[model samples]
Target: MNCWKTINISRDYGTLRLIMFSSSTVLLSFLFYYLVMSTIVQTTEFTQFGFVTVVLSLFGLVLTHKLLHCLPIWLFGGRAKIKISTRKLLFPLMDIKLREPLSRNVYLLALFSPLVFITTAGAVGSIMWPQFLPYFSILTSINFGLAFYDLVYASHLMKAPKQCYIEDHDEGFHILIKQAV
Candidate 1:
């Protein structure tokens, strides 16, 4: 096997740029989600959570998003190591290290599962519980921001050869191709 490409999005795209993009995504998605939900629900009363509750809820959402990413991999019989740590002594970070290479399709599925699942849940929750639409919109927008990196990785994987495999490493992901004998 030979590595056809190595994609380190943070290194290639610059951390600042990625952060800016993610921030923009969060703001824009929140606006769009709230607008759509309000139009659909026609709710005059919106429930608000306390600051502590909101913070805890956001943390839970982040953990749920990470778990969703790992779910597809586990279902496909893939192994991954998950490490949880704190960044800046306050923010939590979860790093998922793949144990082996996966087919492009499988890797793509893993990448996208969180975004699809979380977004769908948020949408449905907003519809079913119209009074909590604001909370749902916030969580969904935050998840969208978190998913920006996955979207970037998936975009790169989409351009690789159909038979290629993806391996996650410290720097980023590697696209590998089998060499003909």
Candidate 2:
């Protein structure tokens, strides 16, 4: 599959609308962090097993997050795939590709799904295992870090709605926005 595609942004309004739609993810992520982490530091602890668990959970979270973004593309009738660059272990990444163009809203949702899922799950895990809350809190931060790009693209994608993509070619995969019917 081709790793790059140019998104043609033909409308200014669509760009603005996309930006507005994508910014909500950042705002929501912040609100979630505040609501969930307010008292987390004071009440949590870490152990060897907890630390290991947190690391493993983070790996799972990252894979799941990537999968979440791909699901929307599939749901919209496009093919999505992940490819890793073995040469860049220092900055390993996943590349997403899709054939069918989806709506701006669908693309936005795909970007933010990981944040929503990982944060919610981390917060819930903390609550469930109060003694290991610190471990979970650390996992929460890691997941947030993973979502950073999705958040940024969500914003840029909003800005270039007509184009339907916010691609970082050094990375992989670009958002594809379909024309409105």
TM-score of each: 0.92, 0.63
Highest-scoring model, TM-score: 1
- Candidate 1 Cα misplacement greater than 4 A, ranges: 1-12
- Candidate lDDT scores, in order, read 0.87, 0.64
For 26-62, candidate 1 gives per-residue lDDT tens digits of: 9999999999889988788888889999999998998
Over 4 Å off in model 2, which ranges? 1-54, 88-92, 162-181
| Clash tally, candidates in order | 0, 6
TM-score, cand. 1: 0.92
